[model samples]
Target: MKIASFNVNGVNGRLSVLLRWLESARPDVVCLQELKSPDERFPVREIEQAGYGAIWHGQKSWNGVAILARGKAPIETRRGLPGDPDDSHSRYLEAAVRGILVGCLYLPNGNPAPGPKFDYKLRWFGRLEAYAAELMKAEVPAALVGDFNVMPTDLDVYAPQRWRDDALFRPEVRGAYQRLLDHGWTDALRTLHPGERIYTFWKYFRNAFARDAGLRIDHFLLSPAIADRLVAAEVDREARGWEKASDHAPVWIEIADG
Candidate 1:
């Protein structure tokens, strides 16, 4: 099975780019983040026409998430992250596709540290930790895939010193990410390619991509059972260089059938 994640930045604006990748890569399942469109605005026709069925949770001009399954519809499992009814960001979505439980998430960026947004990010991380622990207990074959918005280690960022004060590389967020791995979730890409300076996101400004200044914020975390099936992992870096492409490239993994 092949599963991938891409943060399209804006599903509507980047429809062409997305469709192009979907046609080229043909992943078995895809978790998309940053739709930046409301539910009613999602372009279902285009997606379906591309030979995929999708379920999305969207909000106006902001965060959104979706799961796309090739040749079939994904069975919806959950919509929003639990433990915060008042939280309205469309950042998390879960579904069952081809026997694997997939969780797609757009974790908060938490910019301008020591502020309200930063606080919210930490709070959201806490909720995720709690829920992820429960998911681990369930012992299902699962993978949590998305743009986590945090660089878990110095190896994940191009210039670690430059990002230390930034919300994405701050120690607090990195520690939270470590706690998830410590709870038995496998960081698929890192596990497979340790010591490699792989990255999935690059800033448009300052010729980041050209300079190879990037960050590995997007991830695929596999449960124990699914981890055992992991065979390959890669980042479609060329997609990030496409015309009007998203800052993030598609990240994917291939697993052997059990």
Candidate 2:
């Protein structure tokens, strides 16, 4: 099975590019983040016409996530992250596809450090870690895929020192990310290219993409069982250059059936 993750920035604004990517890449399953639309505003029919079924949780003008699977209806396993029912951000979605469970997360972008936003980012990380523990107990084949907003190491960034003060590069944020890995999930991209500085997101400023200035925030964390089935991993860099493209390129991995 081939699975991929892409942060479209805004599904409506970049529908054409999204459609083109979907058509070209042809992944078996795709996890999308930052749809930037409310539930009612989601273009469900258009998406369906592209030969996929999706389960989405969206909020107006902000975060949202969805999973689209080819030739399969996404049976929603979870919509919002647990441990904080009051949290209203549409940042988490889980589904079962091809007998494997997958999760999509748009982790908070806690910029402007040493502030409430950063605090909330840490809090949400804690909640997600706690919630992941519960999922681990289920012992099901699974993968956690999305833009984590945390760079786990210097090797994962273009210039580790340059990003140290940024929220995504903060020590606390990195530690929280480590805690998630401690639960036994595997970072598929890292596993594939352990020593390479691979990145999935590039800032729009200063022609970041043109200069190859990017961050490896988007990820695919696999359970041990699923990790064993991994065949390869890659980032579709070509997608980033498409017209009206999102800042993020797509990351994909192939898995073998048990």
Candidate 3:
């Protein structure tokens, strides 16, 4: 099946553009992030009308996530990342679609490093790592796809040196990501296009998109059992160029035959 992950930034603002993309791409499943609205505020009617059903977790103005499936309602499995009772952020959502377990995450951005927020970012990564390891034990066809807010390598950014201080490309952040790989999940996009300089997000200022000044922060990690099914992966660049567009584009991957 075809599965895609996209950070729409704001559903209310990018509804029309999102609809257009849905009509064209026609992915079997989609994991969305950065909804930036309350659950009540998400446009359920518009999305349902587009022929995709979803399970979402949303907050007031930050860190919401959802999973959408074409012509079917996803089976809700999780609403938030594990490991904390008080830690509430609309950052994680998981569901089962066609027997595959999928997680859509909006990992902490934690910009302006060397502060409390960055610390939280790393702590959150640790929690995710632990949860990922636990999921690995299940031996199911699982895939975690989302805006992880991490750049795994120098090749992922237009200029690594220029982005050293950025939250996404820091050594600590990359190392944390590597730890997840060490636990046996496959980076699907990297498996398809190893060492490539493709990016999924671009800033609005400075003509970042036109100049191709961007970062690869969104990703999909498949369990070893399902890794063999990893197929095509690409970033839908045009999705970021639409009116009132989101800073992020969509990244998609096709799995083996059902």
Assess candidate 2 and give its TM-score to the true structure: 0.98
- Using lDDT as the measure, the top candidate is 1
Tens digits of per-residue lDDT for model 3 on 1-258? Answer: 999998998888888878899999999999989888899998888999999998889888888998999998999998888998788898989999998999888899988797889998998998899999889997888999999999899888888899899888788999999999999999988889996788899999999999999999999999987898877999999888888889999889999875
TM-scores for all candidates? Answer: 0.99, 0.98, 0.98
Using lDDT as the measure, what is the rank order of every candidate, best first?
A: 1, 2, 3
Best by TM-score: 1
C-alpha positional error of residue 182 in candidate 2 after TM-score superposition, expressed in Å: 1.7
TM-score computed on alpha carbons, candidate 3: 0.98
| Count of clashing pairs, candidate 2 | 0
Instruction: State, as a TM-score between 0 and 1, how close model 1 is to the true structure.
Output: 0.99
Per-residue lDDT of model 2, residues 79-194, tens digit only: 88888878989999999999899999999999899899999899999988888787788888999999999899998788888988999999999999898789988899999899
Clashes of each: 0, 0, 1
Off by over 4 Å in 2: none
Ranked by TM-score, the better of candidates 1 and 3 is 1
